[model samples]
Target: DRYFPSSKLCSSCGSIKKDLKLKDRIYKCSCGLNINRDYNASINLSRYELAI
Candidate 1:
């Protein structure tokens, strides 16, 4: 989905980081989730479910 926030969304806590920039290579969540941005996005993509 075009609106799916794969990179900006925290995979651990499901919170969206609206200010995330392309330069940000690490995904840090307020819930203490610290991971690589690409890895985090991949994890989120793997768990994505289409809302049909």
Candidate 2:
């Protein structure tokens, strides 16, 4: 989905970081999910389901 905020979404809590920048390599969520941005994106992508 083109609207999926993979990089900005927290894998653990499903929270979206609206202020996330490309320079921000670390993905930090208020739910205490601290992980690499790319790694987090991968996790989110893996769980993505396409709606037909």
- List candidate 2 stretches off by more than 4 Å: 49-52
Candidate 2 local lDDT, 3-52, one digit each (tens): 99999999899989999999999998999989999999998888886433
10 residues in a row with least lDDT, candidate 2: 43-52
In candidate 2, clashing pairs total 0
**How would you encode candidate 1's per-residue C-alpha lDDT over 1-52 as one tens digit per residue?**
8789999999998999999999999998999999999999988888886433
Q: All models: lDDT?
A: 0.92, 0.92
The predictions' CA RMSDs to the true structure, in order, are: 1.7, 1.7
Candidate that would win on TM-score: 2
As for candidate 1, its clashing pairs are none
